[model samples]
Target: MTARAMTQHTEKLADKWGAHFPAAELEVLAAAGYGARMGFGERPALLVVDVTYSFCGTSPMPVLDAVRANRRSCGAWAWEAVGSMRRLIDAARTAQLPVVYSTMLDPGDAAYEPGLWGAKNARGKEDSPAPAAGPRRDNDVVDDIRPAPGDLVVAKGKPSIFHGTNLLDHLIARGVDSLIICGGTSSGCVYASAVDGFSHNLKVTVVRDACFDRVETPHWASLLDIDMKYGDVIGIDEAVAHLGGLTCRVS
Candidate 1:
């Protein structure tokens, strides 16, 4: 194995024990390819992940307030991100590009849903509790940003959008070679999706203004890791410019 891969593996091991482990430098090797000035061909799609009720608002693990606090004068950062995401969605529509939405599948078994286990694990109660009935369609994407008739919504089983889903196939079918990823849990789902997107050869750009997490540290760290390694980390305005370039066919 390469020396960098060994370092990553070691970090993963240390992280498992609640230690302060850093991201492996191996990921940074892919960053240069997706920077602002790169040849990301046409057919770019906006991918929104897990923008659902369960993860937002007060459905247990709500960090909207924390994110809002971090944004300062803009008021609510989470709210702002969602608004920017909506605008990006509109831009994709105008460009006739695909908009792919992803959400956690109805986790029928409580034992399998980490979010559910999140409560129990956080409480430190010993006995493993039985799984609760998975959420129905009502628990789908948050009503504010739910897909319309023609939009594509994929149900996934994990944090990574590509895991156990046809996201890549769908993107390929639409001739999408670039991905503008948005949505929640920056350190978790967003980062996981970017890692897999790069592995699959899709040029990835993460809109920092459109992603959120339960904590500031992970959110900031994930952005740093992604910018330094997995993909292009651009602000919302820069992403808008790039998308505009795609339309005008500029560089």
Candidate 2:
């Protein structure tokens, strides 16, 4: 699809979430040299950041209800993104491209605790501990798009996977020169990681359809901002299409 077509993603988000991105400002921003398209690189990896049960909740439901179930829940929006994320993941694996997933360190672990997050989000241990009903941890990646045998799973305490983790080194070792980023909280981790990818001079593409946030406005705004400044925020179809043409960086 065209960039214009891709940009209408915000319009779609506005439809679902209820706030229009000012078209006049969009034009002004574009004229001011934002929103230039930097397509994928020859060797790219699919990066799924924090698609955990804590972000997804127990099942599909509205955000308020989802938060009731799990404070970190993005509600039904998380599940919706999971479907698109799964499709893109399957496409990447079928084409033999590297697929990497990131999750938070287990709650209360020395390596997992961070003061800034704790100060802002006081979600106590009772809320995040492993449930008595099942084997899943609060930080576990949702089972819908579970990491397979060869996929790389990185545990991180920070918003960006590149911070305090070997993700950059892993990408460098794999010869990955670009990234297709997906997964939770559009304004948080996904946005952080995509911009970090760009800062490293790697081509970055965030699959809008495969990412979610608790609410819609920030989700819409973050994607538009990323499209304008950091990277190409395109639809899942375009992301999977690019993944289809790539060769594996490793055997």
Candidate 3:
């Protein structure tokens, strides 16, 4: 789909969540500096969180089947998001910015390996009946925007990529001061990553159209919350334009 179509789709999904906070309230928060924009920095990185087959269902997998069976799948919206995310990824690549992809790894086939999250997703746990010691097939990055030759892929065991991962160190080593983040389950991994990025003193920008969630309400709510405090929530077009501008200035 075209970028315009993707954006319209996102807006329509947000509309399903009913009314948002009043304009007056939003203005008040803005005046109080709650929604300040954390614009891009000289050094930025694209962080794609959990854009895996299990989340977007671009490929058939046992986990995808389970998600559909339980009526908790965001495949419809997530599949739409893939196009926009691809545009952003292409932009980042053209600019030669660091690109990182994160996928959730099942610690083991044991029930408690995923800890609290495993319990929360009891039906959708990553642990397959077969004893596997490594990442599952469904956990691989989606084909449309799979990691390129130099792209860093981090296997995370938690919602936040920073948890038990070298993501922060990697960013620091690359001198990444700003993060352009996108990916699945907007209310979960994306939200957690944005919050952690902010706490770590990095500028965070969330591509609103490039993130998806199983439910609309939490997705919209999380975007609003992140825009208010953690970072800026912008459309994919804006993100691409920003990356293009960065490339121009660098060149």
Please name the candidate that would achieve the greatest TM-score relative to the true structure: 2
Question: Clashes in each model (backbone N, CA, C under 3 Å)?
Answer: 2, 0, 0
lDDT of 3 by residue, 1-251 (tens): 56675455444434432276555555445445565556877899999999886677643334446376433346667878889999999999999999999987743424225557656665655446453335535677888898999999988878898988899999999889989999978999999999999999999999999999876789888988898789988898889998998777565
| Runs of candidate 1 exceeding 4 Å displacement | 1-39, 58-77, 109-120, 123-138, 248-251
Error of 2 at 77 (Å): 0.6
lDDT of 2 by residue, 1-251 (tens): 45776556444434433445666666556446667677778888899999998889879999999987777899999999999999999999888888999998876566756647766765654444345367877787888999999899999988998998988999999888999999988999999998899999999999999999999888888888888788888888888877766644435
lDDT (C-alpha, whole model) for all candidates: 0.66, 0.83, 0.79
User: Per-residue lDDT for 187 in model 1?
Assistant: 86
List TM-scores for all candidates, in order.
Answer: 0.68, 0.88, 0.81
The 10 consecutive residues of candidate 3 with the worst lDDT sum are 9-18
Per lDDT, the best of the predicted structures is 2
Candidate 2 vs candidate 3: the TM-score winner is 2
Q: Score residue 191 of candidate 3 by CA lDDT.
A: 95
Compare candidates 2 and 3 on lDDT and give the better one: 2
What pairs collide in candidate 3?
none
